[model samples]
Target: MSTGSLTGRVALVTGAGRGIGREIAIGLAAEGMAVGLVGRTHGTLSDTLKECVKRGSRGVAVTADVCRPGSVREAVRLVERDLGPIDLLVNNAGQVDAAEVPVWETDPTQWWRVVETNLRGPYNLLRCVLPGMVARRSGRVLNLNSGFAVRPDGHYTAYATSKGALLQLSDNIADSLARYGVVVLDISPGAVATDMTAGMPMFRDNRTWASIPYMVAVTVDVARGRFDGLHGRFVHAERDDLAELVEQAEEIRRTDARTLRLRPYKDDDPMV
Candidate 1:
């Protein structure tokens, strides 16, 4: 599918109120897709919808917490009622640790809150949205993942662990939906300068930040089916050479190169 092919398709974007989510919603609208902007804040979601409308696309702003299954179900109902059956779903709502502290020092409640927002939120969305997609046998789901998922971070354990689980979630769903003609992908925006990232100490002195437009462009490309061959793999907007990755898609599939896995102790290891 090309950008033109996305015209009139419906998309539901969680966290569409601000940052990368807002930009992605606008990008899809610019391509002529009707978008459903889902977020907790009505004001921000409304602003996003206005931006979408300015691009000559239809949109609806629905305030709902993605962490709650019931709320997600209602949100999905409203979006589909206003736009139509969702062709694309973007799970982008997430949170980070309150402070850079070791797991032992982190508040258990706070830790679980972050985990629920980042992991359970996407699971709720998938539960509410996938049924229609599976029935139709045509849709795409994009889980906003992170590099931390593959690397260890002592201070951001909750964030890292949640993202890692989300990666596995995408992989599992992709395998299940493969024969159904549905696509699932895990995309990492690569430390973009957002309100969320501004609070991170690691990025405070960093000179380079990921490009919002670049990430949005990559998202639009994925929505256009440019990277469907890489379904279930992790795509990092900042680090990846997308075209080259597409060229190597078959090789990637054969090797299971991008999905999460455990490394064997040696060549003779049974796990291998």
Candidate 2:
């Protein structure tokens, strides 16, 4: 869809206080979409809302913890009341383990906390926002996933597990909502230089970081339906050539190549 096509549409973005969420909200706003900034801190959410307004788009700042069902419900109600029915939902709020440690060594509370935020938070938002989308028979949902969702990470077990589950959630929801004209996508920004990444030990010595502009561009493309063909699949902004991906989308869908699946030991394996 073109920039003009996006005008007057509404988007609800969690974790819009900072990092990738903040950038995505601003990007969508630049395209003329009304934005609802959801975050735990009012100051940061307001900061992002200001940027959206500065871009000549309408927006509202909603301070709410995504992990809480009541808060998420209220947030959705408020955003819809203020901006109109949400045309898009961006589940970007997440958290990593406080320390990189083996599962056995990880604090149980902290592990659950990470899972609650990364997994439950999105579920909450989906539960609250999907009804309207399905009722209208038009909407898009983007989950900010990670490479860890597709791979194993011994050090950040909680983070990895939560992301993996989130990917499955996206796939299942996409299947259930397809007839309703609701699309769901899992997008990974790679290792962008964000406060979250800065706190991770793995990137301490890494000189390379994903391009923020590129990440935002890909997100905007998804928001505009450019990547709708890849719905219910994974998109990695830093590693994927989107144009090439779009070209291959049909084949990818036919082969179910980008989705998570159990690999059978052999072609004749019973699982296959």
Candidate 3:
């Protein structure tokens, strides 16, 4: 890819105020993508916008609830007005209500909230933004997934279910839109050190892993078409050991199935 591969490209990232989302947005900006930052928190959005501006990328912040269609629509309009047409979308906004409640004791409202933010939020954004991408015949959609999407813990039914659905959602969209030049991917970054994980019981386990910057880097690389051939696949940071993680993802795409597990390439023990 050229040095200016992402130059002039507009990207919208939801839940971009802190942690993984913040890192993803900042990484994209550093790669020359104009960014639209979305979050419910004004202060956090300000911080993220500041980081993007510091990297010399044009950025605008939108305060909206990802669960609400009207709110997402308004945010998209504001972003288009300020940053031009969106060339990429990172559906990163989500919640974890079920992570804290037992499956039997979980309230219907909380379960729905998680499903809404993790699954429906992406659907909302895609419904609003996909037309533009399809019309242009060039765009990228990258959604965040969790390790639990494949191997769930005891009580995170809502999160795990939603993420699993998101994986299929990405695959279906990519398949339907592949001819249009738009790409979709579901990426699980492993156990990233974020506010979400800092307090989780898993963080105390010997299996605890540090967050890798490759995930954020690859997200930008995907948007810039550095890994165009990898569309419709799932990627993980552990592939960093074999080659550029994104490149490995592309090679995996050439095989029969779109789903690829990345742990085998890592140097560590399989149990680790």
Each candidate's lDDT (Cα)? 0.92, 0.92, 0.82
* 1-272: candidate 1 lDDT, tens digit per residue: 22555797999999999999999999999999999999999999999999999988999999999999999999999999999999999999999998899999999999999999999999999999999999999999988899999999998999999999999888887788988899999989998989999779878888889999998888888788898999899988799999999999999999999999989999999987
Clashing pairs in 1: none
**Tens-digit lDDT track of model 3 for 1-272:** 22646879999999999988999998888878899999999999999999999888999999999888999999999999999999999999988763466788888998988899999999989998999999999888988887777676667788888988888777767778998999887777877778776656546463656465778777876786766776886665543342555556645766635563445556685843
Q: Candidate 1's error at 242, in angstroms? A: 0.5
lDDT of 2 by residue, 1-272 (tens): 23655798999999999999999999999889999999999999989999999888999999999889999999999999999999999999999998988999999999999999999999999999999999999999999999999999999999999999999998887778989999999999999999998789988888889988788878787888998889899988889888999999999999988999989899898976
Error of 2 at 218 (Å): 1.0
TM-score between model 2 and native: 0.97
What is the lDDT for 184 in model 2?
94
Selected candidate, larger TM-score, 1 vs 3? 1
TM-score of each: 0.97, 0.97, 0.86
**Worst 10-residue lDDT window, candidate 1:** 1-10
Residue 113's lDDT within candidate 3 is 89
- The residue pairs that clash in candidate 2, if any, are none
